[model samples]
Target: MYQFAITGLYQQVLGGEKLNQIEKTGELTSSRFTVRDFTELVKIGIVNSNTITAFTGMWLAFQLNGISFIQNVDVIFFTIVGSALIVAASGAFNNVIDRDIDGIMERTKNRPTMTGKISGKRALMVALVLGVVGTIMLFMTTWQAGVLGVIGVFLYVVVYSLYAKRKLVSNTVIGSFSGAVPPLIGWFAVEPSFSIVPIMLFLVMFCWQPPHFYAIAIKRKEEYAAAGIPMLPVVKGIERTKKSMFFWVILLTVLPFFMFDLGLVYVILATLLNIGWLALSIYGFKMDDSIKWAKWMFVYSLNYMTILFVAMVVISIFL
Candidate 1:
């Protein structure tokens, strides 16, 4: 029933002409659809990155709650795999929805959705299967985790992608909510309750996204402008975007203080990472070439997130 409903919605949104093009090209059954195309469509990088945070959240929950990891292998597996699949589904949905604008942006032009290597119907089907299965797995782990997963999908697909991306400059901020939910899902899967640790983890991820994505927006401002996407850098100019990044990075510095229970090592490491990011954010104002500075900021943000989450799991276990 759900499948039929989704197919109807796709048909309505895609219209007769686009559907005919897909059918006439026979791309769905063509040899053009490779494993690489599928991975790209689902954004494996995003899946892997979010899964790390989810796993970190679960591992920290186990340590904090005095639970044995060895005894709950099934729960861990479900939490991580479910989280990854949901995130991947979100990516696939984004690809399908953004296919038009994606073709305009150089960075996204070669994607399977934009290139028509994968049909809209096929991508939608993949997203539906992954989303339903992932949601079921999360529900098996804990209702809280399952609910968070659903909320995350709603925010990413309906709120951010459908509305905010084209209509609002605050789209990145709105999208951050979905990106931050993975860790919460992981924590709830293990503990099934609220706590400051998970909240801090959520804030850490939430704050990290703006600076990270704003940098990409800065580097690709012209492409985004041509695509008519209201990314911060595209809509608000580079200087304003830099100030926003600085603000978020500053907020990120304060979150580690609230996560003190993760120990002095985690706190100290997080503090240093925050300070480094903050320093880089400050440097952006003085740079002559905004693109070069944004690139630097982008690279640091990736390293900062990976290190911070890894520290959380490591400190929780060893300390």
Candidate 2:
């Protein structure tokens, strides 16, 4: 009975019209892997974004701890490169785990995993290699950062992807923990201790993810529903998702105040960014087209994180 049910599900997912479309597009045909395929498999964009935050944290740590970057260039190199590798590994693992659903979502339907450009076993091998090397590199910096890297991978691959992602509406929230760990890893690589600065940075990333992801959920509600993923927007409705986004944005607004060490420039810029995001969230309540509003929110969230993290590095350098 279980076998039959599994077969039925696969048939629904990969048979008939969808199969025709896959065949027509040559998506199911095995092909030689290319650099573009590798980038997609590892989700280079996500790696780059997370690496930026990690770099920001490391830079701030150097500034706050009065350490010379010239003296600790090795640590900086390892931390940045290791963070990127771990994040990329996580993305590859996610692609392997999510290939079934990836084929169903328009945005993800062309992923290397779904297109037969990279086999699942090969992807897993790549993930393992990247994760091991990344963890070792992090350990070369500090045990604290190494431990955080392992924790981040576990949260992302096991806790979020294997568990919460399909079973709970709070999956995005759960996944944010892993996403927030990069900066912590960076700080720990330099300082190897807990402090307000790193904690505030973690909180900044933590509070930023929900609203950012909720916007994606809203924009792709139908796909999420079809994929059987219980995203907040798909399960609870867009209005509820909007309210939640606002709540998170509100929480995010106060986090900057706690990091007064970042200087007045960071504070003001962060405050303005928060206000702009809050205003955008409020405007969502009035927008007739929720999809358009979600797109705006998603774009703003990207800009918000990029600008805020870059500003942190710049402020740490001059201030």
Candidate 3:
């Protein structure tokens, strides 16, 4: 349903350079997918596919917790489906909102939008479908879980796509809410209980997003500036962005000790992870920052968050 809509929306909404590419290629030889055919795919949720795949790696972390039985068949099932839907919806919305800007940027120029594989109306429908389904499925877990799903959708779609992303300054802060929900989703999945620990995980992600995005923004500062998008590197200097990244890495690393009753294993591992990030940031600050360096940090950040959350589950096991 969304395949066509996303593509249509992209081409009509954003008059990108890729259109010429398509024109030159004369459609038949072009590598890009067409709007009509792509939309027809029943398996429309690539976001769902990736989310479920990543969740598997992180799922065991929850199992390690002393709780012994974090994996209720129902809970895992619902969490995957819920998160998948939300993630898919958010991805669709992101494509919809950034259709024009994405076309403007070389890196994003090949997205469904730029390729004319989907339309605005269709893309919006896809987003609504995934967003609604994801939220509804959360009800299978608990009302709170359902609400979390809703919050994730709202944060990504409204706060990030509509509000923060365009404004450029502090947009990453607003977008971070969407990224921060994963741990809470996992926490709520089993416990359905609230505590400072889960909140701390949430805060860690919130702090982590800026630096992660700043690194990317710095690397792609030209692309963003050309699109009139206000990334930190473009708005503030790269040095300032590095300094900000350092501040968050420091705070996020130190924050866990205060919020969770972590033992030495968890504490040491998390601290090491934080320090590692801070070290990278320091290096990024000292040298003329490179895209390669930023990419490394970005990849490491993914590993760091996954590791930290898994470690939390482990600490909970022995306690």
Which window of 10 residues has the lowest lDDT sum in candidate 1?
4-13
Q: Each candidate's lDDT (Cα)?
A: 0.88, 0.89, 0.68
Q: Scored by Cα lDDT, where does model 3 land? A: 0.68
Q: For each candidate, how many residue pairs have backbone atoms clashing (under 3 Å)?
A: 0, 0, 18
Which residue pairs overlap in candidate 2's backbone?
Answer: none
Would you list the rank order by TM-score, best first? 1, 2, 3
For model 3, residues 235-268, the per-residue Cα lDDT tens digits are 8867777788888788887785864466667777
Winner of 1 and 2 under TM-score: 1
Flag regions of model 2 displaced more than 4 Å. 1-31
Better of 1 and 3 by lDDT: 1
Best by lDDT: 2
Residue pair clashes in candidate 1:
none
lDDT of 1 by residue, 18-111 (tens): 5447657674334478999989989999999999999988998999999999999999999999999999999998887786677678999888
Give candidate 2's whole-model lDDT.
Answer: 0.89
- Give a tens-digit lDDT track for model 2, residues 1-319: 3464334334433434654477467666466889999999999999999999999889989999999999999999999999999999999888877876887899999998677777665677788899999999999999999999999998888788767898999999999999999999999999999999999999999999999999999989999999999999888999999999999999999988988898988899999999999999999999989999999999999999999998998888887
